[model samples]
Target: MSTSPTDSVLEGVLADLAAEGDLLETLVADLPEAGWRTPTPAAGWDVATQIAHLAWTDEAAVAAATDKTTWDALVTELIGTGEQGVDLAALAGGAVAPVDLLSRWRTARTDLAAALRAHPPGAKLSWFGPPMSATSMATARFMETWAHGLDVHAALGVEPEPTDRIRHVAHLGVRTRDFAFAVHGLDRPTEEFRVSLTAPSGDLWAWGPEDAAQTVTGAAYDFCLLVTQRIHRLDTSLVATGRDATTWLGIAQCFAGPPGEGRERR
Candidate 1:
């Protein structure tokens, strides 16, 4: 059968997810025992906790995609619990051994990718923010894995090689501009802002209206780092040319939840 538009979108997302997953797995594959205990950029979270959090979120994603009852139960439990935030949930993984954490993360991530692929193309899965199609959900998973992977690599004092996969992250960042504003209790920008980035392959990746007065131009990797809250806006090479764009760069966040404490410029 010929591929549908939704299938094509999901296929691309799944490929990105695989690339991101492999990058993280390779980075942590040979980590020393002490390295697992090393504190990452995320306050109080060690490398082990980072991987465990990925595993936990991956498992949650699978449930959200495949089983509404299970996903709803999880949502209810999280809501009922007074301390159901990202940091708190991630830190809970500190109790797991490093070996077990890695194993669990590997299994859950693999399962998550499979579950996403199996989900109907047009069906929406409930998420922390809003319902999303399988393609968008996979993209979110890739973004999270990449962001956490950066934290792990940073703690180990290693820089991950840049890849075109970051295009997915950059796209998500631009798409979430409104959601970021809403999360911060601010009004969304009335006008569209152009976002243009130079990808690792030296191709131009862009979004929003081409002739929009507001624009953000920069390296794709830096843009991804900015949106993921891995680096502060002032620290990157990104140039925001309008008030809205500038303000967006200051508080851009790809993940769901309250604003995060971004990294300080070195």
Candidate 2:
């Protein structure tokens, strides 16, 4: 059944969440005990710790859905921590340990998705700060699932083929172009930019104006990896077609927050 973009976005995220969870399960099924302790691509965090953090995030998602006060407080705490001249990188990059965090994360994610699916479309939820519709909340969850899956992909050395659904997520990156510009204190270009992605199903997912002067071209999977900060900008064949396009090429971000350091060509 066809659904509105808002509904579709959440639906897609839920689907992807389920799929990624299955993949993670398979990836860790036969691993050695010490493999869980091995460091992941995320600086300083090992596989076990990453799983634990993912679980914590799932719990946070549930809290946001049911506890507005706690949700608001958590977001405030995060932003305050960021603004207090705290070195986020340093804080995030310390203490890589393996723990039994994955199971909880997996379970929470399942429960959260189920609860969200049952909520009314107009349901109000507290996120980072403002009250967001249930739809926006779903999109946020999708963005995190895709972004974190990147970490798992890196750890497993396996490249997940891009599904047409990725375009659903990638579109978030494209539409958020203005926000990305604002993140760097730059004015958002008044002009539109085009994006084309080749999906795994042998179908094409296209967005923006065909005649847009600025364009991003590449396989859809690569584009997803780039925007999600999974693969390095240089590692992907995705290219920008206009003057400032390249500058914005690798900097696309759909997830929330005060912008992050864009991926660099290492």
Candidate 3:
């Protein structure tokens, strides 16, 4: 991978996600017989279900990328099968063992990453909601993987740091900050805010105008966790300074479409 600004950030994210996936694989594979049955934060779903869901989603993403027949067909399948609060629930409800599901998931991520590297950056691709560049779609998938990894992190009581690339995923969330607010029927802020991430490498990832009206300061992992709604803002000492800063913190979204409810507590 080239070490240009964009490629560097993206590669960093890929490496971080890969490491997290390795941890996830080990955790699921080592689970006691009863561990697979332990309930995850996701409603009515256990660890097995979560792993299955990851496998299913990852495969669908890869299908959208490489298979001509699977282009829009898979998106239709997902929307048709999924219901509110359980988007992957219906797809993952199977008899497969947690280990099997995770193994498949590992393969899918590996394949997807390879596909992304092979395709040209500007290649158009089919995603769930909108058409996107291959690179953009890859970034979205990366965010999804990281977000779900946070769930496992929560369950395992481990705090995983983003080595450096979390800034890519975090930038995605920053881009959608307005969309997230609008999803909640709230007005997008007129004022811009600066977001600075102190990555585990001690390198800084900064977004927004340097002299913006508001600022959010924290470790990159905490910011990623907050924007993804994996961790409640109250759970960390992430600082959102300025009046508009608090407002932006209230709604930060990375995904497309209507904004999600996000976390209730600030």
Candidate 4:
């Protein structure tokens, strides 16, 4: 049986997702309890909370893939419950022992990979925002893992080894250009912006037309950091060539939910 293009694409995304998760695990595996309690740049979140949030979201992604009933219930419980405070699941998960929390994250991500691989091709799964194909969901997972890994690495006073894997994040950032405006209640741009990024491998990865009036050009790493809100606009090397394109850099977010309070200038 020949595999579909979607299947091949999903396999690539899954591989990158696992690698990103492993990178996070390697960073946290030997940390002492106090290290897990160290504050990251996410304001109130500690290192443990970052890991726990990844684990919880992985579990939720699995539920979204495999169980509609459970997914809907999760939506009801987690989606509109800012009234209960931010990320009840992360807070609860972060309260566990560091060892147990690590174990759970490992298990949840493993299960999530399997669930995504087994998901029906061409089917869209329910999510907090729009439904996503398995490939898109896995890519989103990679994006979050990389973003949260940034927090953990920062907390540990360590620099992450940058790789071409950040292309997944950069791709999402370019794709969410309109969402960035819409989320902030601004009108969507009437035209597509050309995005050109230099990947860690020194290769160019670009999107949109070669002749588009609006253009965003930068390093893929900085673009990923910007879109994830891991780095503030003022700190990145990204350059935008049009009015809305410049503004989009300020508000760009690849992830779902309300706009996040981004990082401060270094």
Candidate 5:
């Protein structure tokens, strides 16, 4: 049987998600034990804490798909709504040894992939924000993994090798434009803004009307880094044409929660 378009999209994002996770693992897997304690860009979160958070979130995604009771309890406890920050300390999973933590993350990510695959077709999974379909959930997971992985990379003094997989992150950055505005108590642009990102493979990935007055254009990798708050907007080559679009470049965020102060200007 031929793969349906929907099936292909799901498979594509899930595969990209797995690859992103593997990349992070490859960077950190053989690190010295003391390296796990290295501080990252995120305040108060060490390298181990960053990985632990990713693993905890993967497990949470699995619970959201497979166990309503656990999911609800987790959302109420660890997943905060706007105004409050996530209690990362609560989701630490108590893995003290570096090996134990790495093993936990591996198991959690594997379980998350299985849970997403088994999710009912055409059904939505409840999240901190609006409900998400299986594909959307996978994309969000990939977005988070890449964002957090940057933190680990920075702590380890390694430059990330950008890939086409970040198209997922760039897509998420575009899709969440409205949410980015909403979270910041600003009005969302009434008309869709044209977004043209140059992908790593030299292909232009774009959205919205081609001739839209308000537009954002930049390297897909830089845009992803901006939206994830990994890089300060001032440091990017991104160009914005209109008022709303210009404001977005300053505040864009693909992940959940209120807007962060963002990285220091460079």
Candidate 6:
């Protein structure tokens, strides 16, 4: 049997997820007991909290993919507790021991990958924002893993090797341009803006009209970092031309939420 286009996309996303998960695991595997409690770049979150949050989210993703009832209940509980913001989830996970939390994260991530693969490619899964296809959900999981991994790595004072996997995140950032604007009570850009990025392997990846009046041009890794709010826009090499592109860069966010208070410039 030939692989369908959707199958191919899902496979690619799964591969990316595996790579991201491995990176995260390898980065924090050797942390000392003190290191687990060390503060990360995300305010009020420690290394243990970061991994716990990932574990929690992976379990949630599995529920979203495989069991709507459970997923809906989880969402209701989260909302009912008034637990808003990403940090709350991380904080909630802080009680687990480091070893137990790491093990749980590994299992949850594996289960999430399996669950996502089993989901129908075209079916929409519920999320914090609009429903997402399995591919988009997988990609979102990859992005979250990468972003949180960055925080973990930062807390440890280490840098992760950039990979082409960030292309998925960069694409999500571009696609969410209009959504970001809308979430902030601003109108979407009337005209499309060109987005050109140089991938980690020196290959150019792009989106939108090549001749569009507005343009965002930069390294793919930097672009991903910007959209994930892992770095301040001013700290990146990204250059945005035209008013719309510039504005979008300032407010760009890939995750669903109210507008984030992005990182301040170093």
Best prediction by lDDT:
4
Clashes of each: 0, 1, 0, 0, 0, 0
Cα TM-score of candidate 4: 0.97
For every candidate, C-alpha RMSD to the true structure in Å: 1.4, 3.8, 3.2, 1.2, 1.9, 1.3
Q: What value does the lDDT take at residue 136 in candidate 1?
A: 91
- The TM-score obtained by model 2 is 0.81
Inter-residue clash pairs, candidate 3: none
The C-alpha local distance difference test score for the whole of candidate 4 amounts to: 0.91
Residue-wise lDDT of candidate 2 within 143-254, one digit each (tens)? Answer: 6666666676677777755556566567767777787787778878878888877776867777888999988887877777776677677888787888767878656677
Estimate the TM-score for candidate 6: 0.96
TM of each candidate vs. truth = 0.95, 0.81, 0.82, 0.97, 0.95, 0.96
Q: Is candidate 5 or candidate 6 better by TM-score?
A: 6
Give candidate 2's total backbone clashes: 1
Pick the winner on lDDT between candidates 2 and 4.
4
lDDT of each: 0.87, 0.68, 0.69, 0.91, 0.88, 0.89
Name model 5 segments beyond 4 Å from true.
Answer: 79-85
Local accuracy of candidate 3 as per-residue lDDT tens digits, 1-266: 44556565556656766776776677668777577776666666666766766667667667777886875676566576654424554235424665566567778879877776565555777766667765676677767766766666656676665655566678787877777777778877888889888876888888889998689888877788777776666776678989867876666667665655554454
Best by TM-score: 4
Q: Write the per-residue lDDT of candidate 5 for residues 1-266, one digit (tens) a residue.
A: 88778778999999999899999999889988888888899887888888888887888889989999999887777545423335444235433888998999999989998898889889999887899998999999999999999999999999888899999999899999999999999988898789999999999999999989999998999999999998889899899999999999988999987788789977
Q: Candidate 3: lDDT over CA atoms?
A: 0.69
Candidate 6 displacement at residue 151 in angstroms? 0.6
* Predicted structure 5: lDDT: 0.88
Cα lDDT for residue 60, model 1? 91
Predicted candidate 1 versus true structure: per-residue lDDT over 1-266, tens digit per residue: 89998898888988888888988888887877888889998888899888888988998999998888998888887887634555577777756677777788889888987898788768899898889998899999999989999998899999888899888899899999998899888999999899989999999998888999999998999999999999878789999998988899999998887788889987
In model 6, the worst 10-residue window by lDDT is 80-89
Q: Please estimate how well model 6 matches the true structure, expressed as its whole-model Cα lDDT.
A: 0.89
Better of 4 and 6 by TM-score: 4
lDDT of 5 at 157: 96
